[model samples]
Target: MKPDFNAMTRKELRAYILEHRDDTEAISVIVEKIKADPNIHWYKPEDTDRFPEIFAEHQKCREDARRNQENQ
Candidate 1:
């Protein structure tokens, strides 16, 4: 009755995990896939010097939205 995780896309696998948190086998498959995937890498701040400026702009947008919400 169990679904085949190997046949599923990453998004489908994630959805499966959310629906079946108790399924350890599916969780293991996702974890292993992530670990084995060379393309799945962490971001380093030095790699993107523009991150601070981009983050600041994001924060300003959030603050402006919060203020608008408060005014409405």
Candidate 2:
């Protein structure tokens, strides 16, 4: 039986998605989660000047998440 993607943590879901890249349902679930995040920032084509700052923040978030996951 397949695991419940909706019940998985962000880290668990990410690992599952990596191991099961063909699972459209899991991908859709992750996409929905991302879309539902209130902290998500949308960048426009004209916001080129802010791209570096935006990407740096994104990288920091990824690193923080990795550290938190490791500590767990």
User: Among these predicted structures, which one has the highest lDDT?
Assistant: 2
lDDT of 2 by residue, 21-53 (tens): 999999999988888888687788988888899
Global lDDT of model 1: 0.84
Show the lowest summed lDDT stretch of 10 residues, model 1. 38-47
**For model 2, what is the alpha-carbon lDDT of residue 30?**
91
Model 2 Cα RMSD, 1 decimal: 4.3
Model 2 scores a TM of 0.64
Q: What does candidate 1's lDDT look like per residue over 1-59, in tens digits?
A: 99889988778999999999999999999988888877455567684887787678768
